[model samples]
Target: MDRTYFVYMMASCRNGTLYVGMTNDLLRRAYEHREGLAPGFTAKYGLKLLVWFEQYETAHAAISAEKRIKRWRRRWKLELIEKLNPRWEDLYPGLVPGPA
Candidate 1:
């Protein structure tokens, strides 16, 4: 079965702590982070804002992108986020589906 993979960036706040992750289910994973269900760096630092994300057709490509971005300099990551979200707004609400 075909499945989608996502590379997403979460942050505590604008110019705050950042976290990179990959998941098959973006909403669920992001929710888990938001709820502090997965205790770790994100929980410790409160990185609940989804600053940026990209979808991939292949798992390999998604994994590669996530890995590469995780190693990037903080300034570069910030620039990437600003390109998609100038104000560093929480994108989770926008991603959620509207009522049918």
Candidate 2:
């Protein structure tokens, strides 16, 4: 079966620390980060805002995008987020699995 993959960017706050990651379940992964369920950088830095994301049909493409974005210069990454989310609003709410 075909599955959706996501290359997502999470942030502590607007123009704040950012993180690039890939996952098949964007909602669940973002929820984990928001709740600090997963240990490491995000939890340590409190990067819970899902500021941006790009969907892919294949894991290879999503992983490639994640790695490339992770290596991007901070300025370029910021520009990317700004292009889609000028205000850098938390996108998590919109991705929630069910009624809010």
Badly placed stretches (over 4 Å) of model 2 are: 98-100
* TM-score of candidate 1 against the unseen true structure: 0.96
Q: Which stretches of candidate 1 lie over 4 Å from their true place?
A: none
TM-score to native of every candidate shown: 0.96, 0.96
The number of the candidate with the highest TM-score is 1
Q: Model 1: which residue pairs collide?
A: none
lDDT of 2 by residue, 1-100 (tens): 9999999999999999999999999999999999999799999999999999999999999999999999999999999999999999999998766855
Q: How many clashes in candidate 2?
A: 0
What's the CA RMSD for each of the models? 0.7, 1.3
Prediction 1 global C-alpha lDDT: 0.95
Model 1 per-residue lDDT tens digits across residues 1-100: 9999999999999999999999999999999899999799999999899989999999999999999999999999999999989999999998789998
| Candidate 2: clashing pairs of residues | none
Clash count, candidate 1? 0
Q: lDDT per prediction? A: 0.95, 0.95
